[model samples]
Target: MLAIRLLAEPERLDTLALPVRPARGEESRPEPVSVTTALPAGVVEEVAALVPATRLTGAPGETYAHLRPGRTPGRLLLVGTGDGDEAAWRRAGAALARAARDETYITFALPDDASPAAVRGLVEGLLLASYRFRLTDAGPTPSLTDVDLVVADPATHADAVEAARTTGRMTALARDLTNMPSSVKNPQWFAEQVRAAAADLPDLTLRVREPADLAAEGFGGILAVGAGSVNGPRLVELDWHPAGATTHVVLVGKGITFDTGGISIKPVPAMKLMRKDMAGAAAVVGATLGAAALRLPVRVTTLAPLAENMVSGSAFRPGDVVRHYGGVTSETTNSDAEGRLVLADALAYAVRELKPDLLVDLATLTGANAVALGKRHGALYSENDGLAADVLAAVDAAGEAAWRMPLPADYVEYLGSDLADLHSSPDRGAGSVTAALYLREFTGDLRDRWLHIDMSAPSWADGDDAELTGGATGWGVRSLLRWLATLR
Candidate 1:
């Protein structure tokens, strides 16, 4: 764990000025720009002149020049983001993150006039951008170790700074868990790891539901998904209820410890990365732990449907319809599409049983999402504008890549079934939307207030987000944490 020391004063951020600016066409030079936005235009001009550029000139996600002095060891990064809007702020953060390498420390000299939200957005982006997952013996952990934020009032930004650090920790933990092998992080092992992480936290309760409990609770999705594996399955429940929480948030994650595609087996190449199928669940547990550690006032409950989707005589087959917790029967169209089956039961239980104020489920549910957003961004689908907007704002503030995707009403026809209440998958084209639509059914009317994150691309990355060293990137933890902090 790397420690980034933050302070509210400008002394440290200002004292490290370079003597000479890097000239154009200069290789290995630092680009230093002053961040300016709607609220901080004055400081932008001031910092811009210092870099021989106008602070108000850099476009969002753009940079002006590098500050490479003769004596300084590190370069000064000048990131351009439009007026301190949340989107621009997040872009600036992404710019900084993209500029960092694993072994070095990067510092952001923020505009003194920016709002507290903008400052939070900037730091959140940097931290998320700096993340990396190195679980194998391939090489050492990433070098981008520390990030320093030079702000105006450290006291005023205390809450945001702590929130960012906590979120970063949670995301990192998720990445570590996702990067491990199936042999090490099987269903039972993963649940125990989550338990161990939460044991020392105050006011936090952890429960692991075995197959019997799942069966008793009518969680057929989890049972059938894990039934094929020798390792079995688990339902991990984590709860945090602070003193006066008004909004109760429920997060259900699809934790396929390893997915071999069951009886409708997948190609050998596809089976290799099934271990990371649990990335969504790992993300939920990590976010839950982060919220509790931060002691956020919002009541939080995270349900992870943990399992191993493998092939065996016991594995559930395609064309089989299983009744879920809320009595909804789903015709399994494709055994490979098992993530939604497990999530269906979990989401139904969360809505009908827990009746939370808001429900959000994260999963690497489809390769379609990956095809749509590539690895740079995660697709977000929501039936509620207000809730979706709030989540978008949080994602913007956190500097994680996210884009709003629609859940078309007409697409509901894709999930129609002849045998059961619904079909697990729609016929091919626009698969991502169909998957979102399928999950929407389990939400009932609550879908109006619900949000679905198709994290198929982010959960597993091949180093596309330079910060992530080609493994589990711990994608959603930071966004969820930042959102929880705002509720508190």
Candidate 2:
């Protein structure tokens, strides 16, 4: 983690400078302008003159650097802030951080027009881009440690800066958990981590149900999914309620530690990235922790049904019917679609017991969703327009991309099964929507307040880029946290 501190002004210290520029044309080099008006008068002009105006356009991720000739040689980094929106600023911060990855200490000033919220986004981008999972020492240690955030009004933006710090920390935690290999991060390990996290949070209460408890409580969906793995299944519930909080929001996450596609096995290549299938659970945990840490004035309950979907004689197979928590029977059409199965039990439990005013479930449920929304955005489905609008607003505010997808009532028939109440979608078309429709059956009358997010794409990244350095992106944490804040 980068140690970030707010600075009222830039002193006479040798630091890496960050100057923003507008995006460049396709044929031209970027000529970036100085968004660092808050920097000392001569610093911006001096840095701008160092790079040729037409040599580099100020495009996002575009970088230009020069070493000033002096007793103390200082590095100047010019980054592009394209449209100067929250996303652009975050990209600019990421580019700058990536460019200065080897530095021991780095300093950059926020743009003058940057709001407190925008400043937070900038910090998040920088931290996210600098992130590297080095648990096994396969990569070099991170050189950049201390970061100085130059702000014109530190006193006024203190609260926002602190909030950004908390959000960034939580996001990183989620990413770390998501990036862990399945060999090390089974259902028990996940439960222990959540327990430890909840112990530190004063307002949060932690509950873990082992395999016996799950069986006794009739969480058949979770049990069936984990029947093949040597490690048993677990259902973890975390609750955070503040004083005088009236609105209750329940977050359910699918916790498939490693998905092998069960008896309906997937291709070898597709199975490689299955370790990140639990990203939804990690996001919900991170969001819950962030809300508690920030002291948000809303009650939040997080439910994660943790399991491993493996191939074995004991594994639940196709044509098998498993009754979920609310006695909703689902016939398995494809075991690879097991994420929704585990989530089915959790959603039903949340609805029956928690009775939240709003219910949102996040899952890496389908490749069809990735095909529909691509890797850059999560697919959000909600029949209720008002709920969709609120979630979209929060997504915009958090700068996490999510496209609203439809849940047509007619598509519910795709999940029809003669053997059970519902069946997992066998067809490839509209698979994401149909999966959501399947889960909706468990919500009972609470369907109006339900929102399903298929985050199969955005939850993990394939390669290092400007905003995120590959691996787990912690996709839903920011949006969930922002949505919770609005409820206050």
RMSD of each: 5.8, 2.6
> Which stretch of 10 consecutive residues in model 2 shows the poorest summed lDDT?
28-37
Question: For candidate 1, lDDT tens digit of each residue in 200-240?
Answer: 78899888999899989899988988888889789989999
| lDDT of candidate 2 over 1-488, digit per residue (tens) | 88888887655346655655653566654443545435544665666565565366566667777776672337677776676677777777788778888788877766666677667767777888888887685767768887787777787678877877877888898898999998899999999999888888797899999999999999999999999999999999999999999999999998999999999999999999999999999999999999999999999999999999999989998889999997989899788889988999999999898899999999998988889989989999887899899998998888788999877877877888899988875574888888888888888778999999999999988888766778999889989988989896
Error of 2 at 120 (Å): 1.5
The clash count of every prediction, one per candidate, is 16, 7
lDDT, model 1: 0.76
Q: What's the distance in Å from true for residue 421, model 1?
A: 2.8
Q: Tell me the lDDT of model 2 at 304.
A: 94
Which 10 consecutive residues of model 1 have the lowest summed lDDT?
12-21
Which runs of model 1 end up more than 4 angstroms from their true locations?
Answer: 7-122, 136-152, 464-469
